[model samples]
Target: MLSSHCLNDDPWNKFPFTGFVAMISAVLTLMVDSITTSVFSRSGKEEPHADVASAYTPDQEMGRSHHGDHGLNLSDDKELGSTLQLLRYRVIAIVLELGIVVHSIVIGVSVGATNNTCTIKGLIAALCFHQMFEGMGLGGCILQAKYEWVKKAVMAFFFAVTTPFGVVLGMALSKTYKENSPDSLITVGLLNASSGGLLIYMSLVDLLAADFMGQKMQQSIKLQLKSYAAVLLGSGGMAVLAKWT
Candidate 1:
């Protein structure tokens, strides 16, 4: 982003120092989040009620299929693993949404600040497909999270409103919010850069890795090949959209 109409525009346009810092910040932020999520998820083991615990004994433990200290039994272990996996997906959804929010805001603000009718029209067309595909991906994650209806609604509501809110904000400041201005360029560029980093990391690590490295995918060569084809097709479509954007 810093390569376009930015401080690095002169001579050979390239990503600037600011972009580097923003990318670094994104990495650090994700690292902290990863540690926090791992610690929290592990510590949040389901505990038996006090009464049940009081009556439980070594004999009771022997009766149950022990899966280490965090309770036993095959069904409960499966359920707990599923719950934890869903929780991880929920975190991914939130993080992915946050990145999308920042990116959507940048797109909306740029659209709002620019007076170029053709640019605005092209953006509007491209963004419709972009948001549609993005929503599909995020919706899949949210569905996997298996949140209650209220939480699902809240997440959907936030994602839906963010871009429009950015457009409104940009319009309110349009008089002074020059898209190419030093302040606007620096701010928007850094945000875009950081959000890009976050999105890339989450997509590769949390989303793709989860699916591609799973037992089902690993066990089926045909499925893996088909999945790769789908990923490439989607990626190619996004690349085309980026060109217009």
Candidate 2:
């Protein structure tokens, strides 16, 4: 006998376990983050600069013959290097999208569960900012991937639609959903844990590590310091937001 009055009367009651679920999500995320870092570091090797250089084609001008054929030789390292960059970019983009979609769906579910105006308003603001930054990151990856227009459209659609889909699902289930119930706790906890782990893995390993260890950052002491500071600031801001939403 689910009734609309049930939510209005027991709003706070569903919250305790929901809060626990969120925290569980956060903790599981941290553990997955740690393990991914460890595994990647262990398996990584100190690649030689010459090997790195060989991955790329020789400069087009340098390789150009007097006959003016500027096409990179199939055997040229530069062509291979460019191909590798393209591969890396596409893989990272897909992984990043997966993480973002997870976070978005969870937030959408939270919104669907609530009749509280205050919560929704705060979430809207945070989510707008979140989507903007995430879009920038994913857009860069997509551009680098150089997907054809159709494939690009499809990926974009998938990223853009996930939140709204979650909202629809949540709305449909709102009557039966109880965020604080023991069953709800276990369900949300495990879901959040999995999503959080995926996010942390993508953020630290797929994104941050790649940038930090890249040659450009390694060579620039000043940029390196600034980037780290920016990371701290971003992480701190997200942490503060967690307090409210």
* Cα lDDT of model 1 by residue, 34-98, tens digit: 98568646654553221123233578556554547554476566655655565577678878887
Candidate 1: regions farther than 4 A off: 5-22, 46-72
Clashes of each: 0, 5
Q: How many backbone clashes does candidate 1 have?
A: 0
lDDT of 2 by residue, 163-229 (tens): 8887787787788987666555555555665666666666776679989999999999999999999
Per-model TM values vs. the true structure: 0.81, 0.69
Candidate 1 lDDT score relative to the true structure: 0.75
The count of residue-pair clashes in candidate 2 stands at 5
